[model samples]
Target chain A: MNVVVLNEVRKGFYLDSVALMRLSREVAGSPGVIEAALMMGTPSNAAIMRNAGLLEEGTAVKGNDLVIAVKAESESAAREALDNAIKSLDKPKTQGEAQAAWRPHSIAAAVTARPEINLALISVPGEFAAAEARKALNRGLHVLMFSDNVSLEDELSLKQQARAAGLLMMGPDCGTAVIGGAPLAFANKLTRGRIGIIGASGTGTQEISCLISEAGAGISHAIGVGGRDLKKDIGGITTLMAIDAFDADPETDHVVLISKPPHPDVAKSVLERIGRSRKSYTVCFIGASEVQLPANARFSPTLKGAAELALGHKQIGADFDANAVASRLPRSGRGGIEGLFAGGTLCAEAQVILAAAGRKVASNAAIPGVPKLGVEPSAGRDRLIDLGDDEYTRGRPHPMIDPSVRDDALRAALKNRDLSVILLDLVLGYGAHADPAEHLAKIAADRGQDAPVLVASVVGTEQDPQGRSAQIRKLEQAGFIVAPSNAQACELAVAIVQNAGR
Target chain B: MTDQDRPQYQQLLARKVEVVNVGLEGFVKDLRDCDIGVVHVDWKPSAGGDPQMAALLAKLGV
Candidate 1:
């Protein structure tokens, strides 16, 4: 009989034991059976063994506790294993359960059996992700985690485990990435080149990964450290590890770090860590630029600039001047600036910039929710809100994910008599659900002749060259002025309002 | 063995109902009831036919 071991398949959350035991007994007493043992640690695993009838007769082990063995030859045995495992099992556990597992093949085995598989991506749910991750690490495979909603506790623990094992865990909710010049889920494959990326934003990572590749640089890996890894308690655990890995990799030369604003303390720690590294670094923390850069680190006003600066270094007509972009920006009239963003970090950084300029912005607003836009006499406040915020978005794609939200807001902003200026973040890359250009075109088409909509975008070429170019072309064709950095967009928006008031 | 004369022969005949059967370790007793045929199918949506069903159908040459 040929024996096959199915690896990494796991019981979802809320596993049951009774049904499995009955199934186990059926398998054990089957004709032509040689021997089989159901191997598992969870309680429900035992039930499967008992039903297969491998349990010693008169043994005290209950169905859930029974561990049984059975033997059969060929594909029959393998099928029996799968059948006996899921018998009488009811509904799936919470979506958080790990419903999948992976089999580890040795390096030589992998090379021989799956030579074409240059990448290994993982998408098991959060609960059992760590164990499967461990198996991937043991096999020396690069892992891309698509599961989100993981606890910070599990994230830190798993990251530490991954680091020790010497593997990459791309995300807890890593929505997009490109590897070895190949498109993975939500990735746009482009020409490969120099800048390798480590980003907190999955879309941001996809954009930068594609940009670097488009700029004639190949990515060694685009590691996504999930949004929460840079928080105070987590302290950039995965980000730092990914950075070091990128630094050592011969395939990567430039590294870009993108995230929404983290806690001040965590930001400082991240800056310190980046400062210690010898590699050239470009950073775009969405809200505040709290941490001063080390000699090798450079800060950008937007993720777009960071990608360009990291990949092309100094390109002509590409404004690398930070203050220039800031100066070019239109100020929020003495009123408040209304900044509606889909990405969290973009909001965080915008608030920091506003506060530093002696302006106050509401973070998570509660009541009387007319979002502030222009400057006011009391204080120059900036309102940073997510179009994808729970109050506004759910079940629906976040504004950044889809452009229809932008058009709706554009119409609303144009109609508001009290509104000074409108601000938006347009993200483009692989895995992004909508095109920024088409969205901008809709905004341009919908705008009242008198209202000027200020547009800012974090877009680039590597992930989806055709899509990126198409979005840019569409926006340009619409006569809507586009800015590269979020700060620049804010400044431009404010300038338009301030100039109008004068 | 004629159906009339074979209770002992039926026991011997029943054992021949299956070909090779393999499962996890220790659950051999489940096979005691060889009266019914057991088939296994993968959980994937693409898996349409059970191994036993297919094998049985093939024997019928349908």
Candidate 2:
């Protein structure tokens, strides 16, 4: 392959991470281009390119410099792709760009320019998220923090100040929120009905909303409280506030709260608030079972169950006949399952299911009774891994939107001859990978039938931008068995393992 | 909520939601395409995309 690496091209143009990510994709899609990455020359970025064998001798790059790298079928193709890469850097503007109002260089300038503006949506690097979020909260603007990797201490302080100011601080890692029917950050294009969702998990919210829509109901709003809101430290501040908002809004009829298993005290406080709401609501805390529900609160252990309960129907979890998969197993030590998931909640759900089936399943993050996967154990284990966790996405886009890293990791994991099942979750919605199923399906097609049975769930509605049935059909064509929901998919995988032992 | 203890954000729910997009212009475009009017908050940190940029934005806010 012909490789082209350009150092220090754009001096101070200041392209944010999203712009850089799109630029990389555009260049990679160009004719004859095998691979390309256009980004600021940070150490992590440099390390990424170096791993791909792009960095060269005497190539001195710094964070402020624009580093362009490309590999192509020929030197000429590399040159042409490099030209397109540089052109992408000078991104053009639309006709109305000149007529647009000036951007205020500071939050004060912004608030002064538009007094009606009440929310500041911050998407910067993880380390910088707190400072920007704090500024917005201090200025009386509710903050929607899209950046992750923020310290929990900063989150607590920010939420504390926001509470003091009577403002909402949505997340340091919030995924989806639709306030007044405005979808933001990885949310589905949902309808404006009377049901509002307060969720900590991104895909969990999408699954619930999509199901609600399918059941002939719509959504009023879906507020993301960030993943850690129900933890003991943050104390479910956003969860209670969102419940209060839904409780007060006359437009809202029913409410659904979606989250992973939370700390007991935090869950109790949140439950008490929900118990007090005049209107009844549904709580779907995945992996958090054996909880007593209040008279006004409905409890669901799965996302699909929550949606079904919210619609006044009981959709029971069905049993899957994965015995055929078990019979094909090699009956050797390599018969473990490797679940590489993009959604942490989905990963946690699978981990819980596998553990309940009397198996050891490790994870990179804390998974209730499951032990934390040590540095090396996390590499290869009978584990359900969250590839979108901070460990895998420090300087990269989330695996939900960018499948490059996850694709590579999964391909490598599939090489394990002992792996009996390769489990995955394909989430289709706004800001998610346009066609996530296509990549994994290709990988599944490459692996032999005896290698690993690829089982997956498509977390979306038929109305999703990426057609849900169409995406599932692609996976099915590529020799994959697709399930209706993530929870069901986990059950199928567990049965595959148990049947193998039989 | 009690008038004395009602949250400050409580009033915002009743009003029309207007957004100020910071750092990423594409989001502003996305919102506008959705027919949701958005205002531009021109914020460029001193170090652009680095950790130090956060402190710079805060200083600018003050």
Candidate 3:
């Protein structure tokens, strides 16, 4: 039944007028909400209603300053929703509450009477994510956090509280997660498959998710154990809990672990835990290449490597073929990779790969090598640009998702006559909405025969998919060479560039 | 990248260049004083708005 609860509406707080309009539009668009009104001010205040677009052509009220409305659903459901929304409202704070901008999307689970929801995937910004997480945990929900930039101390406290309550708390800077066959913010919706994911890196999760989807397998659940979750103080608490959850889940078959290299002690603890479980696991702790894992745990250098291992079939009679990876190798390119990525750790992994390949960086510390292995600042030099550094990426989408920087990066590559090869990475799957190759293909077309060899690696799956292969095929059709893996793409790009020079 | 250096970021602030902060009449006077190309601020929501204040900054051409 549709019932409106008017328990807690305070006046004078801004409802993000633009966001409110969008919410009203979504409501109006929905067949469920028969009618909606935006309530404002008390009876003693200035105006009964100021600028509510949700109001009918001529609806007016005299007594209570309530945003009265009817529902498209049975009155009981609508009324209950209104009641819940009102109850959630706090006295309009002087500066506005954190959740003010986001309209609460009522998932069917919110109304269900189940005491045990498998997961709560959250993506609100870092400032308020802890509170949201605490609220979810208090309600006995296991969390898949996607917020970044949260303080480490807060994450620790939240994890401790959640542990006390026997609930799982996933991320402070968590980026990617999948629950109940749905992709959360920054997730790849792939074709359904049996592989499961447990990651501490959002981008790492994104990379592996895309890779598996591309390999024709899909994730059952991709849990994010936020970056700091594996540290000594935090102690990999959430990762352990997620492992247990996936181990018990009937849907999950294989498990993939993706994260930045952890401390030795923490790594030891994680490896030990994995050894106890029967589920086969693929681990990609980027940069800690030489760590010895037990026989059951396979190690990969990159996120894609972990995914490739997870999606490949087990053979009846085969020597563990280390070099027989079925997926495309990173395209080889000429010139050292001018890595312009957002995350420090991803940049670190790229640099590690470049170093292992004997490539010299030409620029900055982050892109470090003898020849700099990165972009350097020069007076009046405009063409060879450097992004992915902290200076350029603030307040905007990361370099992977934002096409403007990618376009600019490509333009810089094109302008540099010395640049015989363009090395780029394509991150797909959830969290990002733009088609990755949409712009690169244009740049490739513009070059025609002269186009610098454009090589990239896409990370995602069909179940939580980002359509990277289609993007690669499009680039290939446009005459640009495409590689299957980041390593292969880098190798091919370097070769092409070297050949061009010769 | 420290907060202390924020005050030194005049170029960035200039690039962010809002017309209302520059003042409508004074800006127009300065433009006319210089005899440069004129610039107008149409502060209507349908055109370009800063709705919270409901103050429309307009530049009328003859």
RMSD of each: 20.8, 4.3, 20.2
Q: TM per model?
A: 0.56, 0.84, 0.60
What overall lDDT goes with each candidate model?
A: 0.51, 0.76, 0.52
Candidate 3 segments whose C-alpha is farther than 4 A from its true place: A1-119, A312-336, A342-349, A362-393, A442-451, A461-466, A477-479, A498-502, B1-62
Measured with C-alpha atoms, the lDDT of residue A31 in candidate 3 is: 40
- Model 2 / residue A216 / CA error / Å: 3.0
Top lDDT hit: 2
DockQ of 3: 0.01
Model 2 lDDT on a 0 to 1 scale: 0.76
Residue lDDT tens for model 3, A439-467: 66776566634434555555544332346
**Across residues A1-502, which tens digit of lDDT does each residue of candidate 2 receive?**
3455543356545567777888888888988888887766755677878888676667766555677888777778778888877776666777697668677777767888788888888876565678878788877899889888788988998898888888888987898888876767787777668888999988788878876775578898888889999999999998888888777777888899998888999988988888889878898888777877789888877777788889888463334445554465454335588888888878877877777777678888656667787744444447778988887887678888787767776777667776767889888876677798887776656765456677898877676678888998999898777876777777777777666667
Q: Flag the better candidate by TM-score, 2 or 3.
A: 2
Which structure is stronger by lDDT: 1 or 2?
Answer: 2
Name the runs in model 2 displaced over 4 angstroms: A1-6, A25-37, A41-84, A91-113, A289-293, A316-334, A375-381, A500-502, B1-8, B11-15, B24-26, B40-43, B47-60
**Per-residue alpha-carbon lDDT of model 1 for A403-489, expressed as tens digits?**
565566667665654555566666654435446667666656766655544555554553353366566567768755556555556
